[model samples]
Every structure is written in structure tokens, then in C-alpha cells.
Target: MSEQELIYLLALQKVPNIGDISAKKLLRTLGSAEAIFKSTKKELKLIEGFGDLKINSIHDSSYMEEAEQELLFIEKENIKVRYFEDRNYPDYLKHCIDAPILLFQNGNIDLAHKKIISIVGTRKVTTHGVAFCEQLIEELAPLNPVIVSGFAYGVDICAHKAAMTHGLQTIGCLAHGLDQIYPKAHAKYESEVMDHGGFMTDFWSGSHFDRKNFLKRNRIIAGLSEATIVIESAEKGGSLVTADIANSYNREVFAVPGRNTDQLSKGCNNLIKTQQARLLTSVADLVYVLNWDIQDQKKQQTQLFVELSTEEQFVFDTLKKLGKSEVDVLALQCKLPTFKLNPILLALELKGVVRPLPGKQFEVI
Candidate 1:
């Protein structure tokens, strides 16, 4: 993390054709970014996957100059830089193969031992989407999960605001550099976001604004969280791309279902129909699937007074009698179809009368 090491890392990051995977390979083989640059072409060629073009790009002097300039910006702005190998780097993101070699951060962001989830959707989020996003966060507030989003219009901002309203940390994963904010209008929320959580990005100051940047940034959104939730999206949108990336990372993905005719719901519906995402009707589905421990005393007390429907009560009583039983087994015992039993179990979970165990088993709380 010294100035020289950071400069070398920044230069390595700037090298063309050498992405996070390649850079990691070089760093692991050579032991340091400085060594990678200091080594001869013959030495570099010894590494598998290092071709002539990538080697030539590594030797380009301009990258070093650019790195130096970027370093100056970092110092001037007091930006915190996290090397991928450092403990301060995002834990979930570090597991991703293509995660950035460096992450630039602003504000009092903390991710240690925290339950993090990313909420993303279309920029033109519907009113229903807004209500669902807000209500979801409010219901989840007791568990104190961190909310992460793109900081754009609609669902992203709605998630951030709702998180803040509930006194929870929220992170905005920006497509641009910390030096500027896209959309410009969101400037008002920047300070509040910083105070509550902060802005995170791999891009440097003065980086060109490109449409492709949003796609690149989506990986960060999906990588940083254990789960990614798409509240609303069209047939083609960035949120769908994020869901794909999350699935690729072996992370959980959830999509809110909508009516068949709703344009914004098409993407989510497709995701569910294709079994690419879990069909999420309420926060209870998420809580059950992720098996998040509900340890809040107030929440526990409230659950005691919760009234369950006739079906939910039956399912709860069956689960208690059967002890921990898989969803399939519980369905048989309850004489309910799997589909019908799933919702009843979700309702029981929402009432806090039952808890989901690993391998789709459930037990009374």
C-alpha cells in the first residue's frame, strides 16, 4: 500500500488486454506489480496466457505516466484505495474472478461480517416497484442489512433512501469516478449517502464516460452482495445483466413477479420462468431462502402476536409435529401441493412461527 506499490498497481490496471484475471495471474506469479514491470519480456512470456500483445501493452510507458497522474488525484482528493489482496477489500467481491484489482472508496463504509444485498432495477421504475422496494427494506430493517445499488433513478435510489430511513448502511456503486456524479441531479443525496455508507468504484478520476461503464460496474454490484434483487426491469436492462453476473458468481438472485402484461415485469417473469431466479413475492421468501437469523427481540416479540391464516396454521402445526422436514416431505404430510405448501410455509415464516433450515427443511421457532 505504499505510494510506489499503488502506482505500479494503478499502472497494471491501466494496461490494455490485461484485465483483473490476467493481472492477478501476473501478480501472483511475479509477487508484485513492480516486479511484473521490472521483469524482461522473456520472463513475462513464461507465464501461460501472456501473449505478445499483452506483453507489449505492459511495457507501454504511457500507462505509468497515467498511473502517476491518477495517484496525484487520489492524494489530492484523499481517496482510499483498496488492493484486492488487502483485508479492507470487499469480502464477497474478492471471491469473484473478475473483481477489480483496485477499489477506490469514499466515506465511512464498513462491510465486515455484515449481511449485504444489492437492489437493482430499471431507471424508469414503476410506482409499484417503488412501494415494494421501500416496504422490503422497512421489513428487513430489524436485521440491519446493508443495501447496495447503482445510485441511479428509480429502484436504486429508492433502496438507498429506504435503508437510510431505517438507520441502515447503504452503498452506492457508481459507474463514474468519485470526482463526478452521473445524472448530476443526485448530487443532493451524495453527502447523506457518504454519511450513512459511501460511494465505491474501480474507475479513476477523469475517466471517460461510456455506456459500457454501466455494464462493467454491474459486476461490482452483483459481486459485493450475497444476493441481488431485481424489483423491476424491462425485457432488456442492466439489472438483468446484474442478475446474470450474480448467478455466475454462485450468489443468490431474487426477482419480483409481476402481471404477465406489465412491460417492466417481463424481465423478472422471464428470470423466474427460466428458473434463473427465485420468485420473490415478499421479504419472507428472501428471509427463508437465505435463512437469515431473526435475532431482534422486538421482532421476536411481535411475531408472537402474529395471526396466521388457516393454511399457515396447519402448515406450522404439521412442521412442529414432524420436526425439521424438507419442503417436499412437509407438502406430503400436509397433503398440500408443493406450490401451495411453499406459500403457506412462507406465510408461516413471515409470521415468525417457523424457520427454514438448510437443504429446504423447516422447523417451528
Candidate 2:
């Protein structure tokens, strides 16, 4: 967009009470931000849901000056602005009704046809949580999925680091503007993150740093990915909010189960109990639930040489004989308990001798 067009868009974004949904309505009706501002109050009032207060806010001249200043910051910092309708904007996020009309991004980030997943949890993540987060990313690295997370303490940073270690792209969704990092201590990782993926936010430079902004930011994290995973969260926290937002967006939500008594596990357990999220144990669960096609040539070649154990062979034979069978039926037919049969099935899946179907059924590949 041209400088003048960007100025008008930034001004429209600054108008109070005109959120993304409302702004989109105005843009669609008026055709452009410049036209919206140029139109008379009478013209603006005709749009559905436009009230006196909203019209007055849109006509406010002060936001134009603020937009001009923000424009200068964008130019000076070489930041990339992603209009909601632009092709470069995040595909998953564009479907969200409340997604930002403008997203300010920095670094060499790419989202085209990427397998993106957001991992979020409590800031005070436990050692076990950290280990699981790392292991999860490491295992998923082979798929080359983009790892997205809030650039906060604990699990967020851990996810970013793990993704980087695995040579996968990672994105940090910030609550504040790109001009500054929230936790100053994270300054050291900023350059590395920028190099690997980048930082993204809707807030302009010098925007007020409010705690409420974090909750609002959760939507972006949830919106940008095909799925959102909560490794660990307290009974109440922002990660659960992200999970809820993901669900609202009709995206998959996964929660790693924990011991009932553990404080961090309460939130995940509650999510599972309420059927708000799928119970996640390993990468296999995510792959199966998402039905990701693993057609890589290398994996295919390895599958050809895979050697299944006696238990796995028995399970595979039983499943093949039945053509397709749910976990319970196969367990009974194989004379193996469900618990014992599950691992064997997983092993067969990894060996590429079996594929998981919907409703926990499995069939030979």
C-alpha cells in the first residue's frame, strides 16, 4: 500500500470502539480507509452497527496524527505491515473474525503452506513441562512444522528454543509493539528469533503496555495455527484462554494430561474432562488426530525396511485380518489388554505397517 493509504489504515485502526469486525464492515462498505475518512458523518451512519459514538470516533482528527507518527516508526524500523486481506497475511488468522486488520511483523518469516502449531502454557512452567515441550518439538521437527508461541517466560521461550534447535521456523506473538520486548531479559534471544522466524504484533510503537493486552494477544497465537497445544497450565491462566480461542476458531486443541494432584495439571485436566480439548500424549496422537499425511520419501523408504516385534506383528496380523478394527476389538481378538495393545499399535504405526483411522480404529498400510 502507498504511504497515504497506510496512514489512513493506521488511523482507522486507532479509532476507539471500531474493532476488527467493525473496521472490516466499514472497509467493505466504503471500499477503503481513505474513503471512510473522507465520507461525511451521514454516510458513515448508514452502515449497519455504526452508532453516534463510533462515527464520532472515526471522525476524530487526532488519530490521523498518531497514525502519521506510527508510520514514521514503521519506515524507520523497516517493519513489514500485513493487511488482513493481503496474500502475505497469515492464512489461518485471516479466517478469524477479530483478527487484527493490520499486523506489524519483523524478520524473515514465511507461512505459506506450512504446518503451523502453537504451543502455550504457564509462565512458571515446571521442569517436567519444559522437558515435554522440548521433546514434543524435537519429535515433530521431522515434519518441519512452524512453531508459534507467545514470546513470554517459561514454555513460550522453551518452545522457541526447541524449534530453533531442530532447525524449524518459530514465531513469537507479542502483546506489545515490535519496538520493545516485554520481559527485558529476553532481549538476548530477540535477534536469534528474528533470524529464525520473527516477531509479530498488532500494537503500534509506543502503545501502552497493559496486562489486558496479553489476553487480547492470545487470540493471535491461537488464530495463526492449525492447532493449539497446552503443555502445562495452572487452573487459571492465559494458555487456557488461548486454547478456548483456538476452539472458538474451530481449530484443534490439545492438552497434555498430568497427575490429578499437580497444580499445573489442573487446567489441562479440566480441559480434558470438559471435552474442550483432545488428550495429547505424544506426536503420534497429534499426527493421528490431525490426519497429517506422512508421505515423505525418506520415511517411506525407512518404512519398507521396518522390522516389527512379535507383539507388534501379532497386533498387525490381527488388525489386518479384521480389515479395520477399533482398539478394543483388536485388543480382544489379539488376547491382549487395551493398555498392552496400544503400545503395540503405536509401534506398528511408526513402522508404517498400520495406519490409525478415526474412532481409534487401525488398518494395515
lDDT of 2 by residue, 1-365 (tens): 78999999999999999999999999999999999999998998888899899999989999999999999999999999999988999999999999999999998899998899999999999999999899788668767899999989999999999999989999999999999997898899999999999999999887688989999999999999999999899899999999999999999999999999999999999999999999998787888799887666236535446776687777877788899998898888999877556656655665567877999898988
Put down candidate 1 lDDT per residue, 1-365, tens digits, no spaces: 78999999999999999999999999999999999999999999999999899999999999999999999999998899999999999999999999999999998899998999999999999999998898788777767799999999989999999999999999999998999987788999999999999999999898788989999999999999999999989999999999999999999999999998999999999999999999987776887789877655335645437876687788888888998999999989989878557656655665567777889899988
By TM-score, the best candidate is 2
Q: Name the TM-score of candidate 2.
A: 0.85
- Clash-forming residue pairs, model 2: none
lDDT measured at residue 188 in model 2 versus the true structure, 0 to 100 = 95
**What lDDT would candidate 2 get against the real structure?**
0.90
Q: Tell how far residue 260 is off in model 2, in angstroms.
A: 1.0
| Cα lDDT computed for each candidate against the true fold | 0.90, 0.90
* Model 1 alpha-carbon drift over 4 Å, by segment: 296-365
Clashing pairs in 1: none
Candidate 2: segments with Cα more than 4 A from true spot: 297-365
Root-mean-square deviation of every model:
5.5, 4.5
